[model samples]
Every structure is written in C-alpha cells, then in structure tokens.
Target: MEFYSLLFLLLPFAALSGWWMAVRNQRKAHSLIFSRYQKEYLAALKYLVDDQPDKAIQIFTGLVEVDKDTIELHEALGNLFRQRGEVEKAIQIHQNLITKAPLQSGLRSQAIFSLAEDYMRAGLFDRAEALYLELLESGVYKVPSLTALIDIYERERDWTNAINFCQQLERATDKSLKTVEAHYYCELAQEVLNREDPTEAQKYLEQSILCDPNCLRALILSSELSMQMRDYAQAINMMQLVLGRDPSLFPLVKSNLRQCYLMLNTKSAYQSYLQSLLEISFTSPILIEITFELESSEGTESASNYLTDHLRKNPTLAGLSRLIELNTKLVQPAQKNDFQILSELIGSLSKDQPAYKCHNCGFTASYLHWQCPSCKRWNSVTPAVTK
Candidate 1:
C-alpha cells in the first residue's frame, strides 16, 4: 500500500516526463487527463485522511477498475465492509487479494486470517476450522491461528480438538494450561460417565486432578464416581477433601455428603462431624439436616432446642422454620397453628431463591454448573451458601 501511494505521488513527474517525450503533439490531452486523475485521487485522499472512510471507500471503489494500482483501495474497501458488519463482502475482497499475483507474504497471511475470521463470524465453523488448521500446518501465523482453532473447538464442544490445540498453544507460549486441561479432562470424563463407562471416567478424573489438583469439579466428580462404585467411605473421604480445600464449598458437598453417610449407615459419625462444623461456621441447610436427624433419634425436644440455640447466634428463615416445624407437633394445639403459619411463610420465602451463582459473571443458576452457561468459565459457579 505504501508502494502504491509513493508511486501515485510520482505519477505527475512521470506524466511531465511523458509529455516531454511526446513533445507538443499531445500535451493538451495529457494535461487534461492528469488534471482529472489528480483532482479525484487527491479528493479521495483528503477524505481518507480525515477518517471519512465511507466517502473514501466509495471514491476508492470507483477508482479500482481504472488501474491495477488500486489494490490498496480494494483492501480499504474490504476493511470498511468488515467494520460495517458486511462480512460476506469482506471475505470476497480478502479472498480476491490472495488470488492476486505477486502478493506479499504479510498481505497473504492477513487476507487468510481475515477470511477465516469472516467465516467464523458467518457461523461457518468447519470453514473457519479448515482455514485455521491450514494456517497452523503452514507453520506461519501459528499462535493466532491456533488460538482461533481453540475457540472454534470450544464453541463446537469438541473437547478433544480443543485439548490438542491448547497443547500446541502451551508449546507456543509456555503459558500454563493446567486449568484448561483439567476442564477438558472433566468434559471428557462427564461424557464417559454419561455413556456409562465408569472405568474410563475414573481415568479421566484422575488425569483431571493431576492436571489441576485444585479443580473442585474433579473432586465432585471423583466423589460421584466413588459413590456409583458403592465406595461410600471413599466418597465421604473425597467430599471431606473438597471441604478442607475450600470450606465455602461445604454447601455444595453437604447434601452429597449426607447421602454418602446414609449409604454408609454412618449417621452418628456424620452427626459428630456436623456438630463440629456448625460450631465452626453456621449453615442453614446443615442445621435443617441435623435437626431432622435429631428429631428422628432423640425426639422433637432435643431437635427444637438444638435449632433454637443455633438460631440465636446465626438466624435464617429456614432455620427458624425448621425449629418451629419440629416443635409444632410437640406444642399445644392453640399455639401449634401459629408456628405452622410461620413455618409456611419461611418455606414460601426460600422457594424463589437461587441455589447457585457465578462469581465471574453474576449469573444466577437454579442448579450448579461446573462450567458457567453464560460466561463459559469453569468452576465459577458454586452453591450459594448461608453461613
């Protein structure tokens, strides 16, 4: 493009020299042609310099057919089309540029990348993938092309290809791929589990942990797989490991842990654990779970007292309602209805609450998602706890 502009500036001198060569025979016609060309080109250049790309592009497009010198003008018009969301036109222009002879390597690659982007924007993932892979195999535009391929595979849920591309990415930059690799393993493990292949699922989960030991999703899945294999003890161990790593996740594992304890027939063990945990921190759901257990074994009196004691320090509607529900049957009929009403009110209030939230995107979800649906970030969504 710089070559073109430099050549343009020297066109007048070339014309002057040509006029000298032709002598006085065709001077008037040459002068008229030079004047017309110079006037339009200078006007277009002024608009281009002033950032009036619409007018500049229009004037430049009109001039492209006049000479092969307008290749840069075609590029400007293509970029303008892309900026205006006319991706088809942009693709056409860039594709045309690659076909032009004597193309510079930089221009050729730019056109290829731009064409790939246009395909991506047009929802042609296969086309985009092909171009990105071609760029990758060419051993040029490696980083950006691999990045584009990664995004394409991610969007398509082709975790295998995404994993491969990210491996290349880590090789290219030596940036850590620990978290992403872990998520990729998690995705594969989830699919394996859905296909009822526990053996392969276990392998992927182990690989996931090795890739990122801090991945809570891996822990959760590990516990789930252990439970499926009926290793309640190991399941309980995994859930506790998750809690020790991040106690704020207790709410997420608490219900699951309760189920594991039930499966192991270890109620007393869980009761002792829950009592200590509640004293360390308040949990409305654990309080409910514990009160239910207490009422089953020790009767309503102990359960009501236990719930009442916790409610005094860290009260919530759920805790208060559980306490009232436990005591309502033990109460005299006159006061029983009043406690029941309060219990019902608290139940209604808690009904509309969201159970999980994404810390990264402020997206509320009714159930936990290992990867945020809105932001597509792994482990950002967690159980919304009350403590």
Candidate 2:
C-alpha cells in the first residue's frame, strides 16, 4: 500500500488506538528482560523528534548493557545522524558502542571506524587519526583506516606519508595503484620543478614513467624537464610517447613537440609526426600545424589543397580560416582584400572559441590541466575544438 493511503486510513484512529497498540507490540516483542530497553528506546524516540539528539543518544547508550548484539542498531543510528550532519550525536553513539565490553571483532572495528568518520566530519583530524591508527593496530579495519589515512595525508600535503600508506594499502588489499602512484610522483616532480630543482624533478618524472608508462602527466613533466636541460631529442621522444600513450593530450603537447623538433632541426621527423597527427581522432590542431609546415615547405598550393579536402569533410571555422589565409597568399593583389575579409571573419570566429574543457563537469579552460578544476579528477580534461 502507498504510505499516504495508510497514513490517511490510520489518521482518524491514531490518537485513540496508536499508543495502546504500540505498547502491546512492545510487550509482545520483549517482556521483563527487554522492558528497560523498550522504555529507553521510546524515551529516546521522544527526544529525537523533539530535536534533542543529545538526550536521545544518552538514553540509547544506557540501554545497550553488556551484549553487543545492538551494534547494528547503533551503527544505523550513527550513520543516520552523521548523514544529517549531527556529528556530535553520531560520535556519541559510536563511542558508546566501543565502550561496551567484549564486542565481536568485526562490530568493534566497525564502531571504531564510524567514530573516526565522525571525528573527520567534526574536523578533528587528530582524533580521527588516533582512532584510525587504533583500527590499523587491530588489523580488522585495515583497508578503511588506510583509505582514510591516505585522504588525510593528501589533504595535509604530506606526499611521503601518502606514498607510504598507498604502498601499504596496495600490499594489504592486493589492488593495483600504479596509476595513483604515477600521479603522486608527478606531484613530487611538480614540487621540485617549482623549487628550481629540475635534476631532482627529473628523477621523480622518470619514476612516474616507470610506475606507469602511459602516465600523460609524467610524460608532460619529463618533456618540460628535458626542455630545461636542452635535451630536445629526449623532449621530442617524450611528446611522441605521450601521443602514443594518451592521444587526448596531443592538442596540448603538439606545439611543444613542434618547437622541440624545430629546435633540433628535425623537419623530416616533424613532418612525419604532423602527418600522423593530422589523421588521428584528435585532428584539428594537428591539421593546422601540418598546414603551416606544408605552406612553409611545399607552398600555398599544397597546403590549400590539403585544407580544402579536409574541410569538405569536417568544415570547421579553423579549417576554413586556414583555407582563406592560404587563398589570400595565392590571390592577386586586387582580389586579396576580399579573401582577406573572409579570412578576418573566420579568424574572429575561431579566436573567441574555448580551447579546453573538463570532461568531468564541462568546465571550460584556456589551458590544459592534469587535474580537472571542477571535478578534481585526474586527466579528465580534453581539448575543445573550434567549429
């Protein structure tokens, strides 16, 4: 039956019969032994509805006695209060459960974990850490305590501790964390980058790659560090590795690769890379780069032909703008101005378009980020193409 229908049906008889029926049901469920707990529960219910959670918690705690069979009920109530942001009441419930002696191993561990979560909710990280460490010592709630410790260490910017705990978690859980490990190394690499220690940063970047060969953040950092050391060949190799590992980053890293190859005077390799990049799924910026190279080496005719063929398929504002730019280059002096106006219009259209977007939350950004600004997820941002 629908809840509303039951409520309406019971409404007329509620005041007269509900209290008597409730008392009868309580007696039926528990006689002399549970009589005290039943009274406490009803009193707690009254305080709970009256917005006096403190008194409710106290009444509930006194009724638990020695046995821990009520652990589920306490846990349920604690979770409800915590979900309602009543951390104080939740903590009281869990703490009372913990104080009850000879609780089952699992139940005791669960109560302790719940208490730690309550402390975390109350912004008492020290208390939370103490409870979490105690949980670890018991080895009953190892995974949960380790996970909470990881979050705490990350929030506190203690990467070393975070790394150690993450490794411990890996060993305990037998779960692969190579991806997160790679990100941690990248974080260290970035820290050293800001500290003017590219040499140390390079080691962390290398470790990141060794941890996960497909880590794009590591590749980006390695390429940047290679640039600092004037290792253009290695810089180019890193960008190429990124392209193979994560094609979504090609738009972000391609120009840097172009610059690196140009610095090393490797036009043949640049042309080959640009050509491969042009036909990939992420193709617009790659096409633009290739068009520029073609215009420089093979003249405006070849570049215009390439763009014309591609634009017939994709027809982006960027592609059309490049076509106009190439056309104006091939135009006679008199007709050049007309084509130039068309080129200017396409440039204006392309100029104001957003270049990057967070895939997680659709947050637009002008530059790429290793982490999404809105959702805070790693590698969830991609290039937004102009049309």
lDDT of each: 0.75, 0.77
lDDT at residue 294 of model 2 (Cα atoms): 89
| Deviation from native of the Cα of residue 21 in model 1, angstroms | 36
Task: Give the true-structure RMSD of model 1.
Answer: 9.1
Show where candidate 2 strays beyond 4 Å.
Answer: 1-37, 50-55, 58-67, 95-108, 122-126, 265-272, 279-282, 291-306, 317-387
lDDT of 2 by residue, 1-387 (tens): 232232233334333134334434454454443354655656665565566878878887886463433455567678778877888888888888888735556777888899999999998988998999988888778888998998777767677787889899999989988788888889999899878799899888888888888888888888888888889999888888878765657777877888898898888789887787656654676777788888889999999998898888888777787788889889899999899889887888777787888878998888887667577666677777633
Root-mean-square deviation per candidate: 9.1, 6.6
What TM-score fits each model? Answer: 0.73, 0.71
Candidate 2 structure, TM-score to reference = 0.71
| Model 1: per-residue Cα lDDT over 34-93, one tens digit each | 345656656765665565646754564454233233344455556656766778777776
